[model samples]
Target: MDKENARNTTIFLVCMVALLVFYEIFVIGPREKQRQAQQHAVAAQQQAVAAAAPGAATYVNRAQALAGSPRVQIDTPALQGSVALKGGRLDDLFLKGYRQGLAKDSPPVELFRPEGAKQAYFAESTWVGPALTPGPLTQWTLASGTVLSPGHPIGLTWSNGAGLDFARTIAVDDHYMFTVSDQVTNHGTAPIKLAPYASVQRQGEPELSKTNIIHEGAVGSLGGQLRLIAFKPWKKQGDTTFTSTGGWLGITDKYWLAAIVPDQTAQVKAQFRVDTVNGVNVYEADDVGAIRTLAPGATTTSNTRIFAGAKKVSVLANYEKTLGVPHFDDAVDWGHFWFLTRPIFWLLETIHGYVGNFGIAILLLTVVLRGLMFPFANKSYESMSKMKKLAPEIDIIKKRNDKDPAKVQQETMALYQREKINPLMGCLPVLVQIPIFFSLYKVLYVSLEMRHAPFFGWVQDLSARDPTSFVNLFGLLPFSPASVPMIGGILDGPLHIGVYPILYAATMWLSTAMSSQSITDPTQKMVSQLMPVMLLYFFASTPAGLVVYWVASNLFTVGQQYIIMRRFKVDNPIDSLIAKLRGARTPSAAAG
Candidate 1:
């Protein structure tokens, strides 16, 4: 019994390690590449636009609207504010510029017209109290050294004056790329060290750099999510060439959060670079004068613009000069199975577009994928069915070798050969699909198409858990609020933690129950039961879209198993094993 247990343990350990290694190589590696490609494409587009239009600085104003789909206004009575999303994607913080560093009690970026400045639409968001008093927009400063006073290009700046500098007209071509630009000049007597940085920050969330407190505990890892960072470059001496700083850009998705960064030194004159290649935005930042010992009145120039937006792979591919940044985007970490599973994501997305329903699309996608893999699953099922049919004969052999452990294994192997059955065959199909399962998870988690998408009653927000209750008793415990289970919490707390998570947990349990019934192997049976419990605790607060997929996938697998078993007449192998145990308990049977 000890020897048999050891062998089983070894097999389990080996399988897990194999799965992890495969996941890192295929799923994680591709995700890294995707993020890189995205960065490159964004950079190239900016450089290309700069090269094409010398007067692009005219379009470098701030406060320009996001490219597609006007922002949606969110109305809440408790808070005297509204939430609007630009470009159909919402990160942890909404505004990307300096205004994001303002007080936390601010609203989304909006119009701020001064008494008599340029009256240009520079991007910025301001939050005036309910009393409506005005002063220097506290916690804010203008990067431009224009005469500083009240009503001097005042309120706040968004897009870093890019909107004031540029004119935006929808392209006639059927392509989708958004671009912005800005120019920086050395007006000072002495050279000012300059660097270009970019960030996409959502309100009430963390920023995307080492300097920000929000970025603490979220460094040096991609979190298997998309990251967009601007690359800052310096100009060489006589060559006057651009030298890439080549700093590492980080990506992590914790709730409504993601960020990116670049390397820069002292300030320098700069220009905005924009490239709209086949309707794709390429954003770049140039910081000149890294090593130059500026004369008393020396001058140099650099520009910066960013293709700051969603991960639309088709659009990004058009910009070719980003040194492969656009291609290296990241999807959510779904595990190691994404190589095959991503196809399912594409399929689900495609169907969702036509049907206008993500849930229905997932159902259809699951059906199609299961159908394709049916043959392989069927083969494995058949092997197990045959083995079950020979169980009585195998029991006799086991009884004969009851005193000899080695002989028991040898006899079992010989019996399997006679029956043309391979015990491991039952697990191979599972092994092959693990990565695909995880990849699908990544797609489901990162794709913005499912945000706020609904499934059914109680599941109105597919991007978060389906709330069923409101008590948050767990919140008072020592456990981390982020790591707490289901919808239950402090009913009287200041925060209104929703009730959808409890429903999500229930649905997961139901799905797991239905799928666990069909597994014949004791070890697999245990895993089937244990894994869902582990995941339910892990994903209680995970994005609703991910939990939705998990619940749906589990239910679909259960239905598939039911259909396969009924159509093929495969018996429950556990029943006979139970019967054998029952017989062994009888005194006469035990003596025999």
Candidate 2:
């Protein structure tokens, strides 16, 4: 009967695994393939547009895109791009320092693409009123400098046929901020009502690494509140409106940002909107400034700013302090544990500043954190050591109360009280570190400063998954197992635990082995032995830096337990094994 039941359970488990594999292969696979096909079709269409408008910047190349429209060049310390004269939009922007990859010849990161281009993204400013106003395709004459630069600004001028004249002055500093001063004069007989508006828009869902832990979509700080809406949520709602004073809104990628900031003192309306344009998903983060009435011969000016480039933490915090852009630093998704996450970033940043390596910084951070929690860990380990020394007594107590589980537990509690060793003390240390562990992961995953930051050999980018894998013989094999047939994704994804993760696993197993010595139950022992393997898979896909941190933390734990157990005079298996080997070698040396 037992054999038959075991066979039945095995069959059920096998069937469930097969069903999951089939569901993934059929149901999930087809939908992903369809999405990719649609993306390819869109790319092909854009390529056709590029062919029609040869050498146009919107076609493919940034230079050609710049040539497609009359524009003023944007030259600054960190950004290189152009402002289109038509519609007076800030269309093209490239981060001069950041590259698309680690290679020397890789293209610089392109933050903004021009209109009519694939994944077209740009920022525009306009006046909204009852009558016809300057819209897309409206020609605006360049009235001032040939380029937009610090100490030099560009002015654009246009007039509606009804005698309302408009002019906008655009300027940029040494960094990412672009200030726009919009002026309008009503020359007609009747007064005209107008509102200044700005929008940062993308014609399609620009490729996103949609990691749920780190936000990678619409981000805004309005009414002193920070709002993050990911792609899936934005697609469902289509549009969201917020009324706030002295705030800004924008579309954000993981490392790059393009936001429109109204005057710090002005009350404004902001909306995050999405729509299907030309069969492509278009998303926009727009803000409308105060509405003003321009009497005949009256000119009113509205001033605002744009941030378009890498979201460097220091630069953003500086902008927040100087420009008083409330909570501008909140743009970097600090997660729910902002209190802990922010300080962790600051500490890591400070240590990296001194140590000159992120990996070393992580090690030092682990040391500091363990030192901070030394009291709690000492208590836990001391209690555990007491438990280890009391294991014989515990066994006797259990055997005496073997018939009643509740009586055994009650006796165990009484024994713990008499011996002044709390079994529950072990859990307190883990609870405290849980939030810290998650915060460190969030910093590694979201903070732009860590993007592409190198550690040591084999870790050129700490924010990326570990590169070496056993299936590829840690890169000794010329090709990838991912190129294999039918089961490539499974092998390449879940089964891709690499070198650092293995180190993490080893440390975890050693630590767990040392700690699990006193837990003699067969079932509990099995669970403890399997825990490190489960953790290896759990942490396999996390950033390499996070893994390094975990390994360092595990080592610190091992070090702490060694010290505390020795202090308590408890038996340590590692020390016992080492002493036994030493004792074996002593006799051989004397005989020789």
Candidate 3:
């Protein structure tokens, strides 16, 4: 049954690949052509209009400067930051005020709120010194109420009783990261016991209406609007290692670093806590332990760095010294496939810097990635070559063992041992690359660097689908339809489709054909075929960058397989397989 299922799965995979190829060739290609035609038509119309109106040139000049004036009005700093994070709001800490263009259309890189809504506050005790505050951390939006009234910005400040310069300038680029430091000091004559608990809360506003997108399964089945992406800690974890508390500190892909010290010679206990609060995240680091005696003037300090940003492998690897955290580096989840995916992204980024065409970069990247993985592909092909060479013997085994399962297994095992071949040996390299494949998926999804970026040629927008549409008397259509009504052209039916998806599907099919074998089991084969089709459907609406990665990966696989077959001197896997089957057919084959 297992064998049958495996065979069926193989077949299904092959079929799916074939379907993708067909879609790319027949549907997507033509659609892309139609889109190009439409674009040309629009360009001509624009040209004619420009020519007809002498005042059009004046209008263009006015609009051009008008466009540059606002953006070039002031050198408002380039979106500066090592990373960017989007802030989501929940009930506890709602985002109020002019949310007009804030989070309505795009994700929020910075957070803004009103004084009435400043229900949450972050406070920590640090040694009285200049090291703590070199400069003020700019707030994206300050509380209007507080700004109108007398007093400083809504924040906390501690007096440096010890009289030491503890100054540090840490900038908060995006709403993604928050920093917390604690300084335990003997300010009083006697020993002091202090456990600081920090909380960032969100208060509800009755009058202000908030704009938010509802994610599926964000708040369980109940499904409420997502207000903030925060996490908290409920219980303390350890001494000097407080459970990372607050919504942004101790979650997956949320990296946190810390340094703590006890009083001169005494030991300080710090416990990190993390927990969920009604879907709003909170994390707190409590300073544990008490100073027995200050002995006049003594102080201790703790420093921490917290980063809540996109899960990019290289970025995670950059801080590996903190700890070899998994899923943080350039590692893929889909097994061996990542070996190809990671490199593909790297190459595309590299080429994009010079050529400025993500699409072409992807094409080049695919070529390079395939060259790198060619050795594995060659080994696989060599194995298959050997298998094919031994197919005759294998057929004989099948003929003799029509029903002897036990004998078949024994003979096959003996044949493999004799030939110094492991039937599953070829599978390792393929499996190893799976992680790279999965990582590629994640890389494409999280990297804002690729957002809305364009590629050359017909792909003016690599971030979105190549739109091709025609509107008939039947009103406008969402996408260009493949067919129209009786008047057909009247509805301006979609005559052509986007070629990229189809091209992607084709590339997958070619790779599968060269890499995969036909499965004998009907069910498994069916599954194999359905996999690619399902994938095609999934990829249809995904970001073009992701699609580009997959396409490149597939093409690389094909090239790698070709190299493996030609370069590797390994025996044919099929020929060996055949010999094993034939050997199993003999009743006393093992005796020899």
Candidate 4:
């Protein structure tokens, strides 16, 4: 039996290692090569474009792009930027509340950059019609206000040489929403058709998290259904078009959004497209309203709203409730388990509101969850404790039937049935914890509130990986271990585990070890020992808040199991270690 068990363990380990090697070589290696090739192609294309056109869209800086166009100032409480009068585009804006980095002096988070800039992103509203219509290059004259702000709107106007006149009024809320109203008056002898069109365009791909947990790309709600397309797929698929009466579409980052919401009652055609201009990929989400015929001496008006800023849950929910934007809160990437993730975020936020610290709130939330699951966990631990007490009887059965493995198993089952102990009862708590763990992980990964939220003692950003790496002895050393040339990358990768992960690993080991004593199979015992170590590496780069939650949960489980073991008079590692320590101390006490 022992030989067979050892063989099975060896085979299991070998298969796992082989699978990992195959995945890395076949899956990861090819994808990485493809990504590198794409990057090189883009670089070559940029160089070609720059050579062909000296002052084209080839990496012009933001300051230069902003200076190349005349503009009207935007000075709202939540936004600061200028609208380019050249195209009358909301192409330069910053979020006043967020910074590019965690440092106090870091620049305000930029939401929009002008056309010629590298990675330029902006939103624009225009009339889609004749060649003379106010388009990207048609210079507009400011007619009304000098500054755009809440309760104050600015007007811009343009005219076709033939007699078609266009006027645009742009207004902003105290927050991130912009209201763009466009009016066209046809004074020509003949009738002309025009449609309102709005687009949010992004030039060049921004840095992405590259994980499947949260989405970062084109997103929208059209015809009552939500659509999400990532960058690669968006390029591959070319253009996706939809016709919906009332909907919203946009390009989204992990925590930021630039969406266009058309009139709730108007039928419009929406599209998400990726185009290569001057060798740079430009991603756009746009909507065009139904065409209206402008007769002689007649006018038409259109209103479109643009949402560009942070994806705060409350803020999005408020927009959904007030503006009637469908699934606006879905911008947060709540995942398929939104039912659980949303409630978890709400509870965490509420607890933080009262406690004044997210870390403390997480701790209290764990306690509350454990309390809710107390009955189920109590039964599981009780069954485990009872099973531990039956270990001697099971061992005797094994010894008595040493030659016949079938008899050993038969008698063990008989013993369990006679004792009314359900061997599977111990798995109930683990099954219940799976969804809760993922839900909490999603909350920590995507919630804006968790971003840069500080916990006590070194955990300044709950959403970021723990910074005090074990490679640098938890930052006690003067030098960074990750800075040591060739091996630095490895050290900074999985080997960059920190204090919270170590604590989590220790608690997991203790909890698993406590339960593992009842597991008699050698293969099961070996797997039990390896699982915590494997998870330690897997979770080393996860958000610190999630590690903290796991640590607290494991501690709670250990304490609860210890109490149940004591009640059943079952021997456990904690009691055995305490006994050995007392035995060792007796000699010292006598000598003293």
Reference-based lDDT, each prediction: 0.40, 0.84, 0.40, 0.88
lDDT of 1 by residue, 64-119 (tens): 32222223222221111111223112211132221222254545433221111112
The best candidate by TM-score is 4
lDDT of 2 by residue, 1-592 (tens): 3222333543454455456545554665556657778978968876676457655324355566667788788888898988888778988889998999988899989988888666789998888989688888888999999878888998999998898888999989998999999888888989988998999998877777735676877898897889889987899888999999978889888888999989888888999999885456789999887878888888899888999988889999999999989889888889899999999999999999999999899889999988999899889888888988888987898799899877777777788889998776766677789899999999998888788889888888899888778888888988786887876765676677799999999998988887877665665556666667766765766899999998999999999898888988887877998999999999999999
Go through the candidates in order and give the clash count of each.
89, 5, 99, 0
Considering every candidate listed, which one attains the maximal lDDT?
A: 4
Position 295, candidate 1: lDDT: 34
For candidate 2, the TM-score is: 0.89
In candidate 4, position 480 carries an lDDT of 85
Tens digit per residue, CA lDDT, model 4, 95-174:
99988778899899998999987789999998888737887888999999989999999999999888889999999998
State TM-scores per candidate.
0.49, 0.89, 0.46, 0.93
Ranking by lDDT: 4, 2, 1, 3
lDDT (Cα, tens digit) per residue for candidate 3, span 442-534: 445444335456665555456554443223212254443435445343222223324556667677666554444422234543554455555
The 10 consecutive residues of candidate 1 with the worst lDDT sum are: 164-173
**Candidate number with the higher TM-score (2 or 4):** 4
Question: For residue 332, what is the lDDT in candidate 4?
Answer: 90
